[model samples]
Target: MSQMGPPRPGASMPAEKAKDFKGTFRRLVSYLKPRRKKLAAVFIVAILSTVFAIVGPKIMGMAITELFEGAYGQLQGVPGGGIDFGVIGQILAVLAGLYVFSSLFSYIQQYMMSTVAQDTVYDMRQDVNKKLEKLPLEYFDGRPNGETLSRMTNDIDTIGSTLQQSLTQFITSIVTLVGILVMMLTISPLLTLIAVVSLPLSLFVIGPILKRSQKYFSSQQKNLGRLNGHVEEMYTGHQVVKAFGHEAKSNEQFDAVNAELYDAGRKAQFISGIIMPMMSLIGNLSYVLISIVGGVLVIQRAISIGDIQAFITYSKQFTQPITQTANIANIIQSTVAAAERVFELLDEQEEVEAVTTSVLARAKGAVAFEDVDFGYGDNLLIEGLNIDVEPGQTVAIVGPTGAGKTTLINLLMRFYELKGGRITIDALDSREMSRHELRHNFGMVLQDTWLFNGTIRDNISYGKTGASEEEIVAAAQAAHADHFIRTLPDGYDTVLNQEVSNISQGQKQLVTIARAILADPPMMILDEATSSVDTRTEILIQQAMNRLMAGRTSFVIAHRLSTIKHADLILVMDQGQVIEQGTHEQLLDKDGFYADLYRSQFSAKVAI
Candidate 1:
């Protein structure tokens, strides 16, 4: 489906797609409620069309009955008639007219149903994406991007397709089926009873198969997610895989996944497919028995020819809805599976909602963390950590790797819920205020610059919606990205595909920095912001950072000690604690852990 070759060629589909469907179906129904008007319209059209279909057959049977009665002299001929031309013409005309009306409503029915289905999908995708945006950074840890994307795209699409077909068609078939049954019961209850007797048998036979199919269908969705995740991992790390000559291993893994998916698909298909044919054969046999009884009754003069004709038509109609429903077992399972995945995401509790507050005064740029603690789960990354970046000051956080520098920054930005302590802008606690209100006042440039496939202008102006040309350019200039951007052929309007291999890594970092600068927040956070740049670019970024930090609270984290040498205050961290806090000169005087780290770094540089 992803053009990634088949699913991982050897991995098996899981047995449980999820725990249960009750919660999922309930949530899914909520989305449908908003568009109920359209659903009602579809139902109306389907009912009308079914009525017309029944009328067409009834008219034919009536015409035959009229002729038979006239020939047998049971009824006097109309004005000039053996089945009068005018009467026949009227019936035929009404039947034709009803059919035309039916076709018109059918068209309307399909169009409205499709619109409802697709629009619901569109709304669902938007909602999921919005939820993801609000979710904390921890939500994505170890979660496969491929699996998430599949749920948003393929899984959502499956629900849309099911809505388009099953919802409207099933309604139509059911109404038609019921109308036929009523007509048959009116004409001959005995025959109608016989025809539908086999119907219950269908449900009984399909019940267990449906259960198993449901189980397999759920597993199929999950396996598909895993397969996508594996393929995405392989694709993203293609260079490493090739460099390590692991193609054979990759192929073997993929083959195993693919084989499992193939087996699952085949099995689910067979299980669901068997029910419909079995149902149809049983229904047909019932119809044959009913027909034989009806014919015998007609021959014995116990039932009229017209009545028998209508009964046969009713018999076909009686079992048709059941047949159609049975046939859709596979599709229904697919829908349920997809719905389960989508609902799972929808059900994940969103982090604290950011309330909207009145616009505040421009930031005076004071940030403080008083006794903060945080971690992904049971493990604590930072405990009782306290720090401050005064207005117009640059403060740096330095530590051994995984000393929670990034985790700290994430907490300050409200990317994760702080387990303990308070982070404040100026003097107000971040939790007491709205996230939007607080975050709108700071700019953060991440270490990994996420670039969208758009013109360079789009990426830079991403957060600053409705930004003007001069504003974007000015920000770029301040970040030192203007020079490189001008070097590009299209300047501001150059289209950048994901294949931005031609650009240097430092250039992209500068571009991201420019985006943050353009945002013009009262404060800024730069975490290992210059980790990958050359000495020259690092200096340039540092200079731009210095300018950006002017009159603003700034927090910087860098592994290389040389870059953060000018920080107003240095916070030395070790194992989730602030072991030391001072200016660079003050720390140098202590001659402790920071000094030792500095020495080790220089020694390593010399060895290299």
Candidate 2:
């Protein structure tokens, strides 16, 4: 199949081309370290197979020599002058045995090599997956999902294929080259020298092509990842594209990336393609050289006609490996390039280790952010920010975009590390607690409700593993979702498609609320949970949320001022700092930033 186009943002393109070809080659080979036993066995079998094959040409030469001697004796009217059928039969039988052994050994070698290659790839894939899990969200935030996926699939697959095919070919080619050289020398050193002379010329033709092709192959893999990223992004946001009338723009961008990919692929293939015919041309030239030289040796009686025939066969065998080695060299370059990409992912910085044994049992929902300072990177968004919330207090945070509203929740849940100060739950430092235990204390319902392709019951119960049916239905009822769910054709048993388009957005939001309700944590975060629903559905959801938040500490991030009007505390924020905090009446009485925002929204609603 053809490779993909220009890279996706944050896709697994090489950060830089691998400058150390030998180092990358060594690291790629090291993946086989764990399978050394199988590899060693494969090597031994390969050697045995090559040895068996090498004996055939020499034996046939001997058989021909025997026939020539017998015929000459028969012409002299001497004893044993006629064809020696017995000797010929013995030689033929040995040849058949050699051929059979060679085939058997070759099969065994291939089986073992295949086992080693697949097992190594399995280990690599496992390590990459585990590494992904351990890596911090920051690493992912900087990269495209499709790029990482391409590395996981396309790059690893390339390594596996190269190992399966090229590895065996490489070993066989080397052994065949050496063996043929030895056999040719035994027949005639002069002919062997002629065969040896072609090796440098073959390298001369291959070296520059291999060097030039490496960069293009690397580019091809990068472009493939880029192409995958584009497709994934366009398809994932296809609705947005249509709404914005961006289909033509999307196609134009895709074509641009596709054209670059095609160019890279063409250049890579074209450069590498030169190796085969060039090698073949050199091989043919070597064959002709050996033939002429061997014929002279035969005419001079320095070597028998049988030896000349064997030497010519050995010459072809020698050149064949040289050609194969050139091809394998190109494959190795590609494999090494792919290996570098995989290793780059494997080498990414992982999240800071957490205290695995720390547990927060029955958290009372008291949250404190004491002199907390934070930033996405170096911008220093939140500096010396302090907040204290009593258990069961509803804190509604209102801010323009990029005001670090969500960053507060991210820090509370330990999704991102705090740069300064501490966050405490109850009386204990959150950093001292395990992330799982800390996060378990809080339940979140995001604006974009995510529902998996499963039954409604399954999606709701996902929040609490092993939740009983009774608990699921109770949570759904509390979220006011049970009635709507039961109205469906299959009720709670209704299976949602991947997009969950079968249900209305309000219903989807309700299901996510039900999931959070099922978790029933002491602390909750509602990020614009009711923003997208119609007025009637919003009322129903608000009632459900009010009940859900009655005695729990809640953090509500709402753009609509009306939903948070009854909050115990409203934090009005801008540019990562809280500009005002109070109830709706107090904020309006102050006629500050919060009042302005509320008035603006109220006026917009009035205009509507």
Candidate 3:
């Protein structure tokens, strides 16, 4: 459905390092600004949850100490010495209540954060969609459609998932780290120091891995977009590949891109994947050191048995959040990479805003181009070109490829702004009107037909919203599509598949012609509209177009010279300039470029 262009130079190069990671991250965080109240509530709930969970170990250690002391006293034959069931039961109940409240608060925070995360991404997607709409057609023309689609689908999905899952976890990890550290210090500063010793070591091991993996993560995303683009392009044009026997070549290209994607993905995962194990190794070493030191302190009676037990638990708890934070840091790195891509799209130059200074209630269909200069890039394709078409006249543009026929239509429709001069409809400068208003007065039927997945009737009615069923049928009849449609099982109600392959090529062309007829605009553009049909169908379509063009200014771009022999005027164009302009017969009589082209076509037919 989309035209594929050559990949831009260096498209396959490894993605560049993120120029401003902090800036991108700040922009990403700004999305949460709108939900500040919800975020505040989530933070409060997270703090409460961490606080409750942090105190559980200390309270449980009290129960353990009571049992240990009682048993020891009994072994020493002390009077009235045994486990205190009543006190231990009360302590156990309090511990259970703390855990229950902690879990409840955790659930509350998760639910609130989930809503905040979803809403943030929803706004991001909306903004991206609007940004795309405002972007110039040149943007789409310069890149593969799948690359853009990837930003909308794959890249945004990555952001959404990270916000939903990782964001809350990041918050909880921070709170837990702080709360557990405080609790450990209360028990013993010595043990707290031992536990925190792993923090810097974890950072040391993680920093280089993150730094090295950042580029790979960026490369992985870039190559993934390229891979998607290749697949979409190949899939849509699979029939062309088969027709031209380029299956092997297509496979080679796909395999090469797939291999690149695999390489980038593997390296990214491998590099970032090292963080967790390293953190765990350092954490386990810290745990071993804390245990040995804790036993010596217990022997010296420098710390109570309950305090030592709680301190060890806090030591384990301390390292866990550090490990989690490290892992999240890697995830955030990847997410920021995705955000950078999306931001790149959002930052693309948009079409100039429409400055509407004039409005046409109904155009008279008199179109003119004066001193026009335009091009896709810096080099002009049409320079100082001019043309005039009167109301109710059909102007035929005949040219070789790259002769600027389509460029003329693009300028007329205001798809691209002119570099010099002006084009006017009924003497109204096109730039003075909004694009929607300018395009509303013209109907176009191109050689490559477009029909979305819908019933045939719906496709025809797309030209004019709210078109009556009878009007749709009338338009179809005028285009000579009614008969073939009725022959189908569902007739007008027959649903077109995604590719619209259920209908013949001729039928598809007829359907597009019907759509144009239904539009009934003041002007029409037919670009080789009958090129896909058989001779009989072409003749029928030409007749329908003749009726459709009555009393409307029409521009027809044709390659077959015979098709435009009777036009009111013929402009023979070459190298972005009109070489000859006259009635078809008058040009035939001139024995010039037009005459030579006509005779060559005639001779070829006769030879065949």
Question: Best candidate, lDDT-wise?
Answer: 3
Candidate 1 at 276: error in angstroms? 1.2
After best superposition, candidate 2 residue 28: deviation in angstroms?
2.8
- Give lDDT tens digits, candidate 2, residues 1-608: 01112232433343356666888888888888888888888889999999999989999988888888789889999975888979988998999999999999999998888888899899999999999988876677666777889999999999999999889999999999888888887888777888899999888878888888888888888888888878888899999999999999999878887887899889989998888888888889888988887778777888987788878788878888888888888888788888888888998987676665446897898889999988866667789888888899999999787777887887888878888999989968998887778888889999889999999999999999999999999999999999999999999999999878999999999999999999999999998888788999999889989988989999999998899889999988787688899899999999999988888988998899
Q: Please report how far candidate 2 places residue 231 from its true position, in Å.
A: 1.4
State the number of backbone clashes in model 2.
6
- Candidate 1 achieves a global lDDT of 0.80
Our model 2 lands, by Cα RMSD against the true structure, at: 4.3
**Model 2 alpha-carbon drift over 4 Å, by segment:** 1-15, 66-86, 354-359, 483-495
State each model's C-alpha RMSD to the native.
5.1, 4.3, 2.2
Q: After superposition, how far is residue 186 of candidate 3 from its true place, in Å?
A: 1.2
RMSD of 3: 2.2
The models' CA-based lDDT, in order, is 0.80, 0.86, 0.88
Rank ordering of all candidates by lDDT, starting from the highest: 3, 2, 1
Clashing pairs in 2: 5-223, 6-226, 7-226, 8-226, 10-144, 11-147
TM-score for candidate 1: 0.87
